[model samples]
Target: MEEQLRELGLEFTKEVREDFVNFRADPLAVVYPRSEEDVIKLVNFAREKKIPIVPWGAGTSLTGAVACKGCILVDMRYMSSILEINEVDWYARVQPGVNLGKLNEELSKRGFFFPPDPASFFLCTVGGAVANSSGGMRGVRYGTFREWVLALRVVLSSGEVIRVGEPLRKNRAGYDLVHLFVGSEGTLGIITEVWLRIIPTPRQRLVALVGYVSSLDSVAGIIIDMRRSGILPEIAEYVDDEVIRALNEHLNAGLRKSGGGILLLRVDEPDSERMREILRRWGVEAEVLNDEEWERMYSLRSQSALALKASAESMYVEDIVVPVSRLVEAVRRLRDLERKYNVRMPVIAHIGDGNLHPNILLERSEDADKIFDEVARLAVELGGSVSGEHGIGIQKAKVMGEQITSHSGKRVLEIMNGIKRLIDPESIMNPGKYVELAYEINRSEERRSSS
Candidate 1:
C-alpha cells in the first residue's frame, strides 16, 4: 500500500497517532493531499483496494471520528488555502486545511467575521469545524458551524467530486444535502473546500458581565430567568468552581472561586444593564468587566477544557443539551449523577443555549465509556440531545442509537443509514463511525432481541 501510494506521487506516512480525545488511530498510511486531484487519486486507490479512508483536519475532534485501524488518513494540512472571500456575497471560500483563526483574521480585515468561534478555533481547521458542526462560545448567539457553512466541495467515496450547496442565502435547491454532510464527521465523504457565511462586524460594542453564583443551582436558575426575561446574550458561558480551580492551577487564571459557579455573560452595550439586573435578581453577585478583562475572561473559559485535561489523568468531556425550560432540572440531575458516580465532573456550558460540557475526571479510561453513555442517556431522558455540536463518533454511538430510537424513531435511523449508504456505497469513508456505528449497534440489539 505504501508503495502504491508513493507510485501516485503522494506524500505518505506509515505512522498513526491518537487524537485529542485519546482515541488511537492505526492507519495503513497517512497521505497528505495538497490538491483536489490528490484527494481524488487517494480515494480511488483506497476504493480499489477496499481500504477505509478517514479525513484529518487538525485532529481537534473530541470524539473518535478520526481514529481508524489499518485505514488511510487523508491529511488535508497541505491543502490549506483561502480561495475567495466574497465581500458582496458575504461568504468566504477556502480549502479544507485553512486555520479557522487565520480565516477570522482575514475576515476581520474586511470588517467581517465568521461567528462560530469554537474553543479550538485558534488551532482547529475550518474543514474540521464544518465536518463536526462544532459550536463554541458565540454558538449561544450565532449557532454552530452547521449554520455558518454556506456550501462545501466534497469528494465522495467513489472518487466523484460534488458541491453540496450554493454560496447564496436563498437557494431552493433539490434537497438540504448541505446539512446532511455538515455534521457527517467525515463518514460520508471528504470535504475538499468550504464556503462559510460571513457577517459584517457588529457595530455595537458588547459588554461583559461576570456573575459569581453560589452553586450550580444558582447558575441554573439564572439561566432560566435570563431566558424568561428575553435577554439573549452574545455569549453566556459557565465554568464551575472545580473548573476554575483547574484553570488557576494549570493556567494561573486567578479567577475567583465562587460558591455556585461563574456565569460569564456578554451582551450588547445596551442590554448590559438588564443582564446585570437579571443576575442580581437570581441572587448572583454580578460585576461588569472592562474590555481588557473581558478578553482574558473569554480566553480563560475557552481554555477550561485544556485545563481540565491537564488536571486529570483521563477526561471524558460530556456534550449534552436539554431544552431551555428544562435547564434547571438538567443541572440538578447532573449534580446527582456526579454524586452517584463519585467523580469530579467539572462543568463548562454555553448556558444561554443549554449546551453543557461536564468534563468527567477519572484515573482510568475503563469507566469513561460507561459514564459517557450514562450522561448521554440522561440528556435523552431530559428531552434533549446526546450531542449538541460534537458529532456522535465511536464513543457515543450506542447512546445515540438509543436516543434516535426513543425520540426520532427507528425509521429515522434507517433513513440516516440509507443516506450514508447512498453517499458512500463502498462504506470506505470513515467507516464504523458516526451514524454508521449507531445504526450497527441498533441492528445488533434488534437481532439479539429477536432471538
Candidate 2:
C-alpha cells in the first residue's frame, strides 16, 4: 500500500495524526493534494485499494467526523486559493481549503462579505463550515453555510468528479443536490471547490443594545417580546453571569456581570427606544453602546466557548435547539441541571434563533454523557432537534438515532443510510460516523430487543 501511494507522486506523510474531541485521525498515510485532479487521483487509489478516505480542512470539527484509525487522510491545505470573486454575480468561487476568515476579508475588500461567520472563523476552513452546515451569530438574519452555498465541485466516492448547481441565484435545472453535500461531513464525497453566495456590505450603521437582565427568565422574556413585536435583530445573543465571569477571569475582558444574565443585540434597523421600553418593563438595566464597546462585547461573545473551557480541561458543548416559545423552559431546564448536578453549566446562546450551547464543565471526562443525554432529550421532548449546527459525529450519534427514529420514522434513517450507500457504495468515505453511525445504533437496539 505504501509503495502504490508513494508512486502517485503526491506529497505524502506517513502516520499523520490529528486530534479533536474524542476522535483521533491516526491515518496510515496523510496525503496533500494541490488541486482537484490530484484529489481525483487519490480518490481513485483509495477506491481501488478499498481504503477509507477522510477529507480534512482546518480540523475544527467539534464532532468526531474527522476521526480515522487507518484511513487515507487527504489534507486540502495546499489547495487553498480564492479563484474568483464576481461582484455582479454575487458569488465567490474558491478552493475548499481557503480559511473562512481570509475568504471574508478578501470579499470585504471588494465591498461584499460572506454571511456565515462561525465562532471558529479565524481557524476554520470554508470547506469545514460547508460540511458542518455551520451557523453563527449572524445566523438569525443570514442563516448557515447551507443557505450560502450556491454550488460545489465534488469528487465522488467512485473517484468521479461532478459539479452540482450553478453560481447563478436562480437555477432550477435539476434536483437540489447542492444541499445534499452541504452538511454531508465529508461522508458523501471530497469537496474540491466551493461557489458561495455573497452579499453587499450593509449600508446601515448598526448599533448594539446590551441588556443587563435580572435573571435568565427576563432574558428569555425580552427575546419573546422582541419577536412578538415583529422586530428582527441582526444578532441576539445571551450568556449567563457564569460565562461573563469566565471571560473576565481568563480573557481579561472587563465586562460587567449582569447579575442574572446579559443579552447582547444588534439591529439592522435602529429601534433602541422600543428595545429599552421592553427592558425597562422587565426591570433590566440597559445601554446602547458605541462601536468600540459593541465590538468588545461581540468579541467577548465569540470567545465564550474558549473562556468556559479554561475552567476544566474538557466540556460537553451542547448544541440543542428549542422552539422560540420554549426558550424560557429551556433556560429553566439548564438551571435545574446546575442545581441537580451541583455544578455550573455556563450557557452561551444564539438566543434570537433558539440554538443554545450549555457547556457542561466536567471534573472527570466520563461524567458528562449522562447530563449530555438529558439536555439532548430535553430538546427532543420540547419538539426541538438534538443539534442545531454542530453535526452528529460519534458523540451525539445515539441521541441522533433516537431523535430521528422518534420524530421522523425509522424508515427515514433507512433512506439516509440508503443515500450513504448510493453515494459512497463502499462505505469508505469518512465511514463509521455521522448518519451511518446513527443508523447502526438503531439496528443494534432492534437486535437487542429481538434477542
- Model number with the top TM-score: 1
Which residue segments of model 2 deviate by more than 4 Å? 15-22
Please give, for residues 247-321, the per-residue lDDT of candidate 1 as tens digits. Answer: 999999888887767999988888878778877787775887998999899888888889889888888888998
lDDT of each: 0.89, 0.87
- Candidate with top lDDT is 1
Candidate 2: worst-modelled 10 consecutive residues by lDDT: 15-24
Q: For residue 243, what is the lDDT in candidate 2?
A: 89
Model 1 TM = 0.98
lDDT, candidate 2, at 325 = 93
Least well predicted 10-residue stretch by lDDT in candidate 1: 277-286
lDDT of 2 by residue, 227-296 (tens): 8988788899999998889899999988787688789998754676677777788997678889999888
